[model samples]
Target: MNSPELQNVPLFAFATAMEFSKVFPEDSSKAESQNQLIPLSGPFQGCFACILGVGILDFSAGLASLLFNCKQTNFKISAVISLGICGAYPDRGLSLLDVVNVSSDRVGDLGCEEQDGSHTLWDKSILGGNCCQAPAVIQKMLVALPQVVGATVNCCTGTATTAVERVKNMGCDVESMEGAACFAICQKFNIPAFQIRAVSNIASTRDKSQWKIEEALEKLHKCICG
Candidate 1:
């Protein structure tokens, strides 16, 4: 994905470096032997990283700044490749360390709460509509991987009830905190944006012991760098 056109190259964004640490030169054993690999530690060989922060508000604000602030800094992005870890619904055939391309993601929690314990989620009626997609090139590149729907929530779905609500309302296979925001901002900018995430935990389970973040990061690195 390297090119001389820094302004038009795809930007690889992360919520935090921890999720993408496997791509760091010092952390990636494969990086040491592959000199031709896209150097993603920082700005290198037309590849760059923008930390979208850890949550929705920060991600939205950060993404906005990434586009507008670049004008003053003279840096610009033509596309976005947002990568991170996510929680998959246990029944979705997704397990820890499994990486997949997110075909579409919607914010599952933004809506009004009714007095009768019923909630009305606005995701379906949002002006922009849900279903976000990546650029054609990325879709082609990741054609071999399983493409799944994603739900972006205020937090990880730690309870089975919460997970069921999201699945019933958003009909998503996986959950992340920032996917919808990333896609939303990219759509607003009319730039291609995509998400590829690893399953670090199961959305229907609250047991932290089942989370394998380290292994998920390892898999995520191989998917991108190898």
Candidate 2:
């Protein structure tokens, strides 16, 4: 909940209440130390948290509303932290539960498809850039974590073909549902955006048995909320 610098308060944004849906003791240290799943607690001291719903539309609306509220209330947000679990691309040297800081994010599925079945991005003259860069200032604060490129997709990659296509299209190491939208919206608001995600599964397959949802959620909680 604390800003990357711990000097200012940030609005921690999430796509959903995935792991933080349960209420529990405010003191999660005891449970966390015992290697248990820590339940939802209060916002970390001196910060705010917002649920941005799921997908880009909900995320954009929630973030815009929050920004508008801040403007009306004269609340200054130091930055925006997009926190969640992500899937790692194959052969990316990434592992499950590895919390990584997204250095940049790009759109995963928006492009112009040609007759040859290839896709191309829009012309760059009219707000056509699909990639959003995370400010270096915020990234410096998270130097301890591995910094990887990310892609924000409306549909999560559930098959090897989809995964390969996404990586080929986006050149991303990890993929999330709301990362680029968070970054782009924050850009419009002149707020630095930071995305941190814990790897949950290989972005290649939809095999539930191979995914580590609960474990990844626990690691995600520890990474950002610990």
lDDT of 1 at 117: 74
Q: How accurate is candidate 2 locally (lDDT)?
A: 0.68
* lDDT, candidates in the order shown: 0.71, 0.68
Candidate 1 ranges beyond 4 A from true positions = 1-4, 26-44, 71-74, 125-140
Model 2 residue 78 distance off true place after TM-score fit, in angstroms: 0.7
lDDT of 2 at 112: 72
Residue-wise lDDT of candidate 2 within 71-121, one digit each (tens)?
A: 555666777777778899998899988888887887777777889877785
Overall local distance difference test of candidate 1 = 0.71
Best by TM-score: 1
**TM-scores of the models, in the order given:** 0.82, 0.78
Report the C-alpha lDDT of model 1 over 1-226, residue by residue, as the tens digit: 2234555666667777566456444533432221122344432454656565787888888878767665456555667787889999867777788888887888888889889877788875112222234344345556767888988889677788888877887768888888888888887877777788988888985998878988888888777766
Collision pairs in model 2 = none
| Candidate with the greatest lDDT versus the true structure | 1
